[model samples]
Target: MSFTDFFAIDWSGQAVERPKGLAVAHARAGTEAPEIVDRAWSRQDVLEWLEQLARDGTRALIGLDLSPAFPFHDEGTYFPGWEASPVDGPALWQLVDELSADDPHLSATSFINHPHARRHFRQRGDCGDLFPPGRGRFRVCEHGQEAMRLSPYSCFNLVGASQVGKSSLTGMRVLHRLRSKLGLWPFDPMPETGPVLVEIYTALPARLAGMRKGISKIRDRETLDTLLAAFGSAPHRPLPRYDDHATDAMLSAAWLRVAAAQSELWSPTLLTPELACTEGWTFGVP
Candidate 1:
């Protein structure tokens, strides 16, 4: 008998072919050589591959750049909010409280209650339908849908002292690791903590302008800054103004319309962004 395996990792914002993909071939016994490489991918690219790759009794080793042990800062510690925990901590509970205060959606209680809250957590929740009665998948419900949808958002306010490098370093390190996993460059493991000095490169104004066409409205500084940075440069500007009610209404309406339409029948966003925000379900995964 011979065996084969597949390995893949997400690079940048999408998945790229990994060198390990070509490594496995039908073999009786012998260590297969590892192949590593990095390639860019769009959302559609990955979806097509997944559709083709899903098959009976086949498994692919997959990796993502996102933190795996998020919300698990210390084995004995706990946080009430924020899925992404600091590599180090000022006690997990206190950290979570701070995150909860900043971002109301993040909560330790939610992590415990939600099914897909852990990044690396794995289990076969629907395996009962995949067996022959009690032995193999001979009689199973075909209409039973597996896997539940999840919220794709989390936000926080920058507090008294700016932890400017904190987010930047963490995000960049994840990006770099993705690149490395795809064999795009030499592997660089970021020290779990420290002042990792780095720079971010992106067209701010252009990016914000693009989001505006799809956005219904803005709530916090982060979303506003992201939009303003992309819309136009306010030179020597400390922060963007967001108190104009008329502008909010316009943006809110535009954002809600698109988000609702995109959700189709799976999930529905109300007709206005303001209503959507107040409802705490601004977007839906259909």
Candidate 2:
């Protein structure tokens, strides 16, 4: 199964009227550049957009910059000590979907504010105890990323700039809504055809482009162009204002174009059925 196009989304978990951080970009099979699909998008808009692509029979590999699952193994379960803890990734997503069914725009406030479940996440005023400082607050896959020197934060820590907890939780709502329309890598068997979604970390591709630490945001046109060049993509002229989000989305799409061609990325040597079904692995993480 080969992909004819690639997409990458830099998702935002904010519950604002409009999220400026959310960006989408795509690269066609033979295209020399990955173009931004939209300058701004709400979570619902993204969901509908992907569904339309699926309806159109577009066979693309989609990468989302968010953790698809939590640190289940390290904590024994997402909601430890709960009587009805989810058994796997699907169940976990379903629970979030059910909890946030009334949330507008696929926002995950309910799950984030749940009385019991809220204890696992770090909110504005209160920092969750599930992940303490100076100690590891990561999933098994995150540990693997750490081994490679990539600082992948835990999905439960939602306080800092690098934290992905909020975005990932909100992403669950979108994933649950599109589960039937798109195949989720590792969680669902790779379909012989049609669109498929995979969890992506933008840092992986940025690192591949020689991006170094201390430089979290890529704002320079020359630097962005240099990164895109690694994937054979044309340089960006008059680069967009939201360079961080745009570049992240663009570079991620470019990375997917090359990474998807490698059979090993789809088949990690250490991936087990349990890991795939529970703590999802980040695509491109060996």
Candidate 3:
């Protein structure tokens, strides 16, 4: 139940080789401040890094800031009314991967641009007919996050800052590529050895650390270290810049170290077996 390292990824879905929003950070099993990885990373780079972590026999809990699967329980189908929707999270990941296999840099353009699948997403100036009425659907874990006053965006929403739709799809491709190389939580049971990756909403850590909904983003060394201390982590050395991507990665990685000790987080009252397989839960949402 203990991990040698805790890492958080501020992920992106941009089609470019190196996404500007991509960042990664890690905190070892100690009080030392979490460190922002001082390297540029592309989606492919992250995939290779994680594979190396697994191959090195590292015991790590890597939290990915993207939905593992789309809302299944609320609508009972990822693409409601479609006769050929995936049956579970793993299947959905597989579909996204296979469809986007030719997309460069792990991009999911092919899947999102697929004629059958495109109708279910919300794109700029072209809200698909099948797109939901409101802010789109929510998985059980996202609903739990909303219940806590933290805004949750649908993985099917591809427009606006609230849209994580494309990000989730691209992340699913990475997950599919990662299958068997490492364990994906809920979809694949927590492994006793190697690396275990879990879906994480970085805002969860900020909310728990006393930041409000409107301004949960950590922006300054003062603010970041303050929240880091709240997580029982030591003060972090000041970075030359405090971009939201790096700060969120560092704070969430720091928080994961603390969140791992609480047994209740490993089990949630609402996460039933079926939902766990179809709509994976966010790691810190107990």
Per-candidate TM-score against the hidden true structure: 0.21, 0.94, 0.97
- In model 2, where do residues sit more than 4 Å from their true spots? 129-136, 240-242
The TM-score that candidate 2 achieves is 0.94
lDDT digits (tens) for residues 1-286 of candidate 3 = 8999999999998889999899999899999999989888999899999999999989998999999898889878888877779999889999999989899988888988888888988888878888879987788888899888888888888888757877888899988889889988888878888888988888889988988768966778889888898999999988988899999999999999998888898898898998988999998787
Largest TM-score belongs to which candidate? Answer: 3
Rank order (by lDDT, best first):
3, 2, 1
lDDT of 2: 0.83
lDDT (Cα, tens digit) per residue for candidate 2, span 124-210: 688666545653367788888888778877677777787788889889888888887888989998787789899999998998788
Query: How well is each residue in 83-163 modelled by candidate 1, as lDDT tens digits?
Result: 454333222223334333433212133322233223222213432221122211100000011112211211111112221
Please give the lDDT score at residue 283 for candidate 3.
Answer: 86
Q: Say which prediction, candidate 1 or candidate 2, comes out ahead on TM-score.
A: 2
Candidate 1's TM-score: 0.21
- Local distance difference test scores for all models: 0.25, 0.83, 0.88
